[model samples]
Target: MISSFLLPLLLWSIERILKRKQFGWFIVIVTLSLVNNFYFAYYQLLTGLIYFLLELFFVINTIFYQEKVQSNVLSLPHYWH
Candidate 1:
């Protein structure tokens, strides 16, 4: 039961690390969680990983779509180069 609290924190830290490049919180949480309870932490790590993968997918999708839009319709003047 107590181990459940780590899930949210681990997920949040993963998000922060991805969005803000903030590794300190993630590192601390991972270290503590692993040291305190490797068994439960493993599940937490898996959930965090899934979240990270989803975020990466969306981010990549958005970037590609944006580039496609810009390339197809938004032509820049030659002088801008």
Candidate 2:
């Protein structure tokens, strides 16, 4: 029952920790959630992914594709390789 309220905070925390690159907490939260219930764990991550994409689109204030791809240019080689 309590999970209903706490789930949003926990799910959003996944985004905060990830946005800041805290992999340790990310793993801990995901593992803890997964251990409790698979359905919840799935929803938590699913919700987090949706929130992340929404935030990504809204937070960026760019008009050109070049601007968006500029920062990622350096990492493209690694991804391609």
lDDT agreement with native, every candidate: 0.86, 0.70
Between which residue pairs do clashes occur in model 1?
A: none
Question: What does candidate 1 score on TM?
Answer: 0.79
Q: Which stretches of candidate 2 lie over 4 Å from their true place?
A: 62-81
Best by lDDT: 1
Return the number of clashes found in candidate 2.
Answer: 0
Q: Model 2 TM-score? A: 0.57
Worst 10 residues of 2 by lDDT: 58-67
Candidate 2 at 15: error in angstroms? 4.0
Instruction: Please state the error at residue 56 of candidate 1 in Å.
Output: 0.8
Model 2: colliding residue pairs? none
